[model samples]
Target: MRKIIHVDMDAFFAQVEMRDNPHLQGKAIVVGGNPEERGVVATCSYEARKYGIHSAMPCRTAKQLCPYVQFVRPRFEVYKSVSTQIGEIFKRYTDKVEFLSLDEAFLDVTENKKNMASATYIAREIKSAIWNELYLTGSAGVSYNKFLAKVASDYEKPNGLTVITPDKTQALLDHLPIGKFFLVGKVTAEELKKIGVHYGRDLRNLELSYLVSVFKKRGYLLYDFARGIDEREVECSRVRKSIGAETTFNEDLPLNSEAARQVLKALAEEVSMRVKGRGVWGKNLTLKVKFSDFSQITRSMMTSYPIVEAKDILIYVEQLLNKVDNLDEKVRLLGITLSHLLTDEERLQENISLFEYMESLR
Candidate 1:
């Protein structure tokens, strides 16, 4: 059996803010932009969650939920720096680290640097290291495969560790809610309820063909997950396929030439910053526009050279925007995407200063 551990930071952004400023501890705090502005909550503290506040919630709604809640703008650079520190800590045990995001990862420590035979012990040590180095707590879940490891990690939140041994897997999964299982989304959960499938055991009772008929391609994967059988490996060397940023608006923006330009410019800047932060450059720029009718369209351009800077991205963004046919329609969303990426190793060697330039923005 393969030993995998999933590590998830507790309320990452909010926790980091509280760690830096101790006065914010034990208070209902939110990390995002001004509530009065077109801001949304990136993450909120457990105290804030009591008021029904959560990530991706509108800041205004969060404020109404808890009038005393404190809101702070996100510090992406600081968060990225902390993420780098966390990555380094994971590397100390095993090179088999797969980052799900800045705050979560799966580590395959079957053969670790310390030769630790017990996965549970390695998990405890890793959690200890994170706390010692960053003064932040992380939860770890150790199991025989990725699915159970991920499920175990999230079973408890804000600094909890759970282990699902081979013997315990089936019983634990049997009672677990269908929605709690990975990839069984809200829509899928509701669909399962119609057939009296509300838990893992209920799902397992269905014939494989019935599941396949209902969920199509995803049905095969769900069948394996329900039985606690996941053959997927812990891919250590994961590559980002694309980098993009998008905004959902409180009000639709008219497709007037100047109005569209302004939205595209802002989106391009955000995308450029993220691309630079990841040390990647792309040859294709895609402009995605969602109209008031909920219809969406994307226009892309393949450039001769890899693009990274906001100004360069804006140039292509303008070209693509001009290609969009419906100028009179109102837009509800605007996004910029960079594709056909080349990492720092592939292109930065030619221009060392370019990498330095990207870092300087942070």
Candidate 2:
């Protein structure tokens, strides 16, 4: 067996709160809301889900569906801390653990504690440890590879565990919808359905040559996944590509110079904080402006030296203000993004010091 395991926490945030506070048990607990506001749900406890409420639904609509739902705002700092503890647990099983998100990860234990025997055993121990230590439950899926492992893990949810042996692979795949395949998203799934390609079995019957001819680049991917073949690996760690920030306005702007400059300065400050906090510097600055009518535009400029300060980010923002003036349109949202990253060695050679870096570059 290839020995891959996918572990995903069950209602991560809401479960953590329920575990810590006993009184909240057996009640409908939601982890994101302001009750009367327009924000959507982040995650809801299984109790709230009993009323058909799920994550990302509008809070108002969720409340309407389950009127007795107890709304609680998300506490991200707590979630981050809990995620770290869970990551430590996975590290004990294998060094080749890849975190897909705070609540889920994939582990390649081919050369690990179990060592070619049974992958399901390691997954069971990990799930047991999480329940015993953190007072939360998680689901596990074991298979020959990452793709099948992930599919198996979600097959049985909420403290459930499922395994897809090599023998059962074809049978398990026969009934799975094309949409259930990881990369077959909403748009592609609709396209597949239109052509009567609803299940993996249907896709497997279609030859790769014809699929590629019709779909071009994506056709090959469809053929590969249809056979339950995935060449992807688990990357446990990597650097962040970019640091940026965006904020949507409660009302549209009047498109005056005063309004544009004021909004740019505020957005630049938000971007600067993110860049500096990450301790990374950027060489390119891009401004994303969304109009009241939902049209979007982006303009970018490259700086000679990298910047990680509020003052310099504002300078680029000032430069963009002039570029956007001719649009003659009302503004609804403003965002600033920092990209074109530089490594630490490059930063040291360029002499990009913290003190003189911001203002001197201008």
For candidate 1, what is the TM-score?
Answer: 0.77
- Which model scores highest in lDDT? 1
Candidate 2, 330: how far from true, in Å?
12
Top TM-score model? 1
Model 2 error, position 320 (Å) = 8.8
* Model 1 weakest 10-residue run by lDDT: 270-279
Per-residue lDDT for 127-241 in model 2, tens only?
9999888888999999888889889888988998999887888877878988899778776889888989999999899999988998797788778777878777888764357
Minimal lDDT window, size 10, model 2: 270-279
Clash totals, every prediction: 0, 0
Q: Which pairs of residues collide in model 1?
A: none
Candidate 1 residues lying further than 4 Å off, grouped into runs, are: 190-196, 213-216, 240-298, 301-322, 327-362
In candidate 1, how many Å is residue 246 off? 8.1
Candidate 2 TM-score, C-alpha based: 0.71
Q: Per-candidate TM vs. native?
A: 0.77, 0.71
